[model samples]
Target: MGGNGKFHKWKIFYRPSPSKSDETHRREPPPKEFICPICECLMFDPVVVSSGETFDRLCVRVCRDLNFTPSLSDGSIPDFSTVIPNLAFKSTIVNWCSKSSAAPPQPPDYSSVERIVRGLMSRQGGAEEGKSRIRCTEMELIDAVAEMPDVNLSHAVTELAHRVNHFYSSSSEESVVMTTNPPTPLPLATRPACLSLSSASTSDEILNPNPNSEDEEFVAKFNSHDVYEQEQGVVALRKITRSDEHCRISLCTPRLLSALKPLLISRYVAVQANAVAVLVNLSLEKTNKIKIVRSGIVPPLIDVLKGGFSESQEHAAGALFSLSLEDDNKTVIGVLGALPPLLHSLRSESERTRQDSALALYHLSHILTNRLKLVKLGAIPTLLVMLQSGDLAGRVLLVLWNLANCAEGRSAMLDQNAVEVLVGMLRRNEFDSESIRENCVAALYALGHGSLRFKGLAKEAGAIEVLKEVEKGGSERAREKARRILLMLRGREDGEEGDRDGILELGGLSRTRHRVGGGVGKNATIANSTEF
Candidate 1:
């Protein structure tokens, strides 16, 4: 937005005055100067959609930001990719607005509440607008509507809310509406009530439409809604969640969560991706995290992980990553069967998917209960495959390091030949970050505490040479761990047998294969002192 002074003058000049002329009064023509369909004002930075309608670039950009698809006549929608700059119109509007500063003020055509909300919900144009602009516009329009006292205003709000809801559902309407041209406006009585807020029930109840065929006609309508709206609607929800604390608090209601639950399982790819994105942001607040878990989103999210577009998988994994930070969520996610798909994601072609999944795994592994669960679920082999692939080395190493804390995990690793991989990584010495080497050393140290089979496996793989090299030049922590591993290996070679079952203690926490009595059991106390 520019200086309001010039813009205010421009607005006054462009809008028609009541007493300008008899000819203008008798048969008024729509403004020859193109008015923005969005703000209903003279276009400054004029741009045109493929439909031949021109609007302020900023207004059109707001549409793009919302992911709303612009509807056109003839039952067709223009591909945003075809939107172009109106260079000639831009020159004209700029000159007109510049000269209008000297013209007299006239009453502007205030857009109706319905129009304002519709514009907010309309498909986004091709150009991207700033988040600040979108937020400001949303706040101004919502505030304006809220200030109105007319009963019709409430009716309009209810109508608009329903329309917006229909715009997001996973129903059949989306497909039909998207393929057809924009339809003629229906009489008020004929309009569907997809998001109607009834006086008989609370907003939360209205928000919770039936998951299995909402006990109403509109829920079926929801099942048959347009695809474009479904995509943009969730995108808008994602934006709202990240807008500000006030907005986030308002948007993260039980009603809203109920609404979003079906979207996680939506047939629409963008809908699923954006829904996961919103969940990821919502889970940042502790209260929201609890609410999200309770909403039973984990199972559907795992479904997305198992089979979704690469981008959606990333978002689902990211959401899980955020949720995994809470202890309660860890058990719930494990019980709900989120691990297998997560393991599957580690094998995805998309680096971001792998990264997000690995991060989620790392966080979940922090919970002592999840470590054994992960190991038993065949995490060791999957992790070994990831390690051999050479991507996510640091992340994988840290997760492996955590898993190696217990005997079952260590034995699983030994069975998976993790010693060879750890020694191989140490032998490379080409790492840019010392953390990678440190994790490798920590894991090796954990393996070294296993039975004689483990130590022989390491020594057989030339661990002594790599340990000496790392001890000489690695980070101080790596150096210390490497030295300890070398000493342990050499001591064993020298016929010294000292606590072979216990892992080497790193600093305060003894780093060994296992704690004295801490083994993998339902009540096992896996030490909480381990740090990556």
Candidate 2:
């Protein structure tokens, strides 16, 4: 069986070449679905725009930057308002490349895509008219593209193209067309208020008299039977909320929230991602955080966290993290059962998802009820595994710090052999951040409040030796925590009945109780006050 296993490995490593016919078949061009609409090449990072069209991410960015839209074969203009990573499609392309023994596509160069867009724009007018038409200087065009943001560039390009087309359609005999200087760009604070695209407008000019009119339009589009309109509404809202805090405040009404709720779970990747991202933006406003939580948005956000598109899951985790920052939303979020899914997200393939999940769990664990729930949900073992794996060690340690604050949490940590893992990291100097090391010692200090089992565990894990070193060379916080933990460990090892005073001392309690000879008097108070 061992020889057969080795033979199979060898066969996989050294396969024979295919015949001419098979080679010819394997070398066929990638399918149309894999080809980017703008560059007409196999997409390296295919992303879905709000129009439900897939294009390379770079192509989309370049087109948006140049203020030129690709004219698709179907003669439809894609909505470039939002772009969401089509991860499943990208994965399929990768698998096809592997099976066919074909090289995977690389990202198209920016200059190359820019050149293609320029060619398309030039073709918008007749070839003869191109030579006769007065054009903006190349340097001026470069300066305009450099100074403008994506939205401004789109509007500027559209306006420029409109002027050129109008100029050519006229029968005026004058040859020299004096180009007026472009208007000075508005400050960023005023930019979002003036965004007026052909399909969408974010100017709050009508918001005062008819507040719900704009929101009503978006909600109508959001609830439409047409998926493209739904995508356009959500994407526009996403962009608007991201740019203007006022829009975030105004658009977070219950009616808009209700309209957005279903799209959070939409089957379309672009809609789902942008919808959740819009929620994240809404949650950023301090006043909107609790409003969003109370609007029954937490459940769908949790659903997205569980099984939505990968990009949407990242935004969902971010939204939860943002919401969890509010004191009132913390317990409510935990009650909505965000803990398990959030704990699962700590292992997500996306680093942003993992980071946000860890932070959300950390904030939620601040409440005593939530901490106990986390212990019940088996978070200690999962976190310990992630910590040992050295993924997001600093952020993971922050969550562990919160988990270590409760009795059930401390007990769970000891049972999961957390001491060995933490001490192993400290002894090896595994982390470069002093804050991470301090957090490690702080977690150990919190666990020191446990029963004699912690002492045995600490001794077995060689924690005392490591703590002493931390005391000598670590930060002031690390040294202080290490000092207290060392005192507790020695006090326990000394076997003195009054050593409970030493434990109380580690809890920052007065040693006046030393003469009391037992920990019965203020043990509960000490335990409660000393939680990290």
Using Cα atoms with residue i matched to residue i, what is each candidate's TM-score against the true structure? 0.51, 0.54
Top model by TM-score, which number? 2
Per-residue lDDT tens digits for candidate 2, residues 305-410, read 8887787798898788877877778876876678999999888898668867887887788798789888898888888988888987766776787777777888
What are the runs in model 1 whose C-alpha is more than 4 Å off? Answer: 1-232, 492-532
- Considering only N, C-alpha and C atoms within 3 Å, which residue pairs clash in candidate 2? none
Give the range where candidate 2 is weakest over 10 consecutive residues by summed lDDT: 165-174
Model 1, TM vs. native = 0.51
The best candidate in terms of lDDT: 2
